[model samples]
Target: MAQSWQRSYADMKVRDLEFMVGERVLLKVSPMNGVMRFGKKGKLSPRYIGSFEIVKSIGEVLYQLALPSGLSCVHPVFHISILKKYHQGGAHVIQWDSMLLDQKLTFEEVTILDRPIQNSRSKDIASVKV
Candidate 1:
């Protein structure tokens, strides 16, 4: 009975969402995953990529996306928590670009935007901005 009550409490905090086939959604990329590729001093990196089309909804909380050729190695299916339904004219936007991903799903950094040096008591640290 306690387990059932706990399950219900957890479910109550989660929003019930369902995506339809052909809908566009943004896929989230966490800092730990994407930060290494772009040397941005680990700051100002985008947390999500794409307004990719939803190919199919897998059960209730997972959806398959039509990812680009560069991300072919990545599994198309993702959990609902990592996805946000694309809203028309919303602030979150990206100029769609072809990104190359390795087998490990890490992307190549295209350009270096800026580089700044940080001075510490022990040593001077150089940080690359992408």
Candidate 2:
């Protein structure tokens, strides 16, 4: 049927991510609807929060992560759509203890160590040097 073909077409783009016990995975940070609105520069903000270890796969599309003690209030299980396998050599490892994440999994403003203001086209643009 047309609906079956449509489902297959959609499924083609989706990867069946499988995680085993003790494997590490990154938890995607989806923006909260009410409190913090993702502004104009859409892709500027960070996407994933962890490199957190996967405790186990609860179901075909659900995973349990080994979250830190600081995130005791947060739920452990997450859908596969919001999870990505953590490659050992993929990117920089985050210090989970130092990061401040709210209940909505939104991170606080990153500290700007050095910011230089540059004037361009009658506008002052502040460049952050992290």
Candidate 3:
């Protein structure tokens, strides 16, 4: 019975989310300092600040994200409403060497340095001799 249940769940197709951990995504974020005139001038800026890795899921509404610039931050676990996927060209067209050069940080670097500040602090203290 357990096996059957698991199989059914696995067969279900999850909606392809626009943003995922380790995915290079472009966010249509609004600048915090922009002037709002009559609410009609609100604009979204398509700024690509490298890639972000999702660290943890805070319930179903929030996610902890690690930015490429080595900053850890949380973002609203927005439904597909506010996120868009950045599609790199097809595999057939892009070469592996070029793709590697474009990446600013390796996966290991992101995994190690992009953790929450609290976590990083604890690790740092452990490394230092008391």
* Candidate topping TM-score: 2
Model 2, position 123, has a per-residue lDDT of 95
How far residue 68's Cα lies from its native spot in candidate 1, in Å, is 2.1
**Mind giving the per-residue lDDT tens digits that candidate 1 earns over 33-129?**
4355433335565556788999988888889899887677778888888898788885776543655556543454657788899999999999987
Instruction: Report the Cα lDDT for candidate 2.
Output: 0.74
Report, for every candidate in turn, its global Cα lDDT versus the true structure. Answer: 0.74, 0.74, 0.39
Lowest-scoring 10 consecutive residues by lDDT in candidate 2? 32-41
Q: Write the per-residue lDDT of candidate 2 for residues 48-116, one digit (tens) a residue.
A: 667898888887988889898998767888998888778778665455567666677766555569999
Between prediction 1 and prediction 2, which has the larger TM-score? 2
lDDT of model 2 at position 122: 89
| Cα lDDT for residue 17, candidate 3 | 58
Q: Provide the TM-score for each candidate, comma-separated.
A: 0.62, 0.68, 0.30
Candidate 3 segments exceeding 4 Å error: 1-20, 31-49, 69-81, 90-130
lDDT of 3 at 83: 46
Model 2: residue 80 alpha-carbon error in angstroms: 1.1
